[model samples]
Target: MPYSITVNGAVREVDVDPDTPLLWVIRDNLGLTGTKFGCGVAQCGACTVHVDGQPRRSCALPVSRLGNRQVTTIEGADGPEAKAVQAAWAARDVPQCGYCQSGQVMSAIALLREVKKPDDKAIDLAMNGNICRCATYVRIRAAIHDAAKALEA
Candidate 1:
């Protein structure tokens, strides 16, 4: 089946099975590989993307289910909050192996979008789904706080 979906401000028509995960279509068909596939299951937030400005697990989201909603991958998250988070991540040296940073950053960006000054508990709740094998939780929390401060400034 051919499904038309708008991604990163571009409309693309991809031919694939209707049940195919949007992650594969974005990475394989559209060549947007920034959104990594870690666990394939939605348990790992490696395939997190913004569907209509909300973070969603692209790995489990079917391409056919996506109607006219816009999809924003890590490549397209360059807004003010995202930039602040990116800068904070760099300053805090958050990523160790850098494999899970994209998903981590995406989740963090979503959290910050909802909660500007999230405490440790809120951060933990919001970021629980994103599993980082490197176990950089301390640095990740610090970076989130730093990003919040940067946004306040």
Candidate 2:
């Protein structure tokens, strides 16, 4: 069946199996590779995306699970919030391996949207599942803080 999903900001019609993961559909069908596939399960936040403004693990999220909800991937993640997060990520040098940055940035945008000024504990709680093998947690936290500050001002 063909599923009409709103990805980024455009409504794209993808003819794929209902059980197919959103990550694959976004990558293969949509030709958007910003969302990574760290783990097929939801344990890894590598395939994190915004589903109706919520951070979702796209790797495990079935295409059927998404309806009219707006699915925002790294490619489609824009606006002042995304720019702030991107600026913070660059300023703090958040990525080491560069594989997890997109997911991390997506997660951070979600976190910042919810918690305008997230503290260490809040950041930890929000970014708990997203793992970085390069161990850039410190910088990620700093970038989140910086983004919050920039958004605050």
Candidate 3:
């Protein structure tokens, strides 16, 4: 079946099974590979993407369920929040292996978009499932804070 989905502000059509996960559709069908696949079961946030401005686990989200929702991947992420988050991540050296950073960044963007100045508890709650094997939680937290400050400035 062919479904029309808006990704990164563009309406894209892809022919795939209705049950196919959005992650594969984005990566294989659409060729947007920035959204990584860590845990296919959705336990890890590596496959996170913004579905209608809310962070969602793409791996578990079927393409049929996407409908007309706007999907934003790491490749499509932009704006002041994205710019600040990217700058903070780079400045703080947040990524170790970098496999999970895309999801981490995506989650961070959503958090910052909702909460301008998220404290430690809020950050922890928002980023709880985003696992960094290198254990860069401290740096991730710092980068989120820095990004928030940058947005303020």
Candidate 4:
């Protein structure tokens, strides 16, 4: 099947199986490698992306379901929330292995957009499945708080 989906503010037409995961479409077809492939299963938040402004596991999300909705990858993430999240991640030194940070950032941005000033519990809840092998939980929490504060300013 050929599906036309908007990605990174651009329209992408891809021909693949109906059940093809959006992760492969984004990485292999679109050449957006920022969204890494982690546990293949959705248990890991490695292939996270914003589908219509909501963070979703691209590894499991089928491309066929994305009818005309905007898919924002790490490459296309923009606006204040995205900027603050990125800056806070860098300032807080969130990534150690640098594999899961994109997913972390995407999840963080989504949380910030909704909660604005997410607390520890909220941060933990929002970032639950994003497994960072480097054990950067402390820094990830700190960066979320930092991004919330930055968004406030």
- Candidate 2 regions with alpha-carbon error over 4 angstroms: none
Give the per-residue lDDT digits (tens) of candidate 3, residues 1-153. Answer: 999999999999999999999999999999999999998999999999999889999999999998778999999999999999999999998888999999999999999999999999999999989989999999999999999999998
**TM-score of candidate 1 on Cα atoms, chains taken together:** 0.97
Tens-digit lDDT string for candidate 4 (43-143): 88989999999999999989998888999999998999999999999999888989999999999989998998898999999999999999899999999
**Runs with alpha carbons beyond 4 Å of true place in candidate 3:** none
TM-score of each model, paired residue for residue: 0.97, 0.97, 0.99, 0.98
Best by lDDT: 3
What's the true lDDT of residue 45 in model 3?
97
Clashing pairs in 2: none
Q: Which is the better candidate, 1 or 4, if ranked by lDDT? A: 4
lDDT rank, highest first? 3, 4, 1, 2
- Report how far residue 8 has shifted in candidate 1, in Å: 1.0
Give the range of the ten consecutive residues with the poorest summed lDDT in model 3. Answer: 61-70
The list of candidate 4 runs beyond 4 A from truth reads none
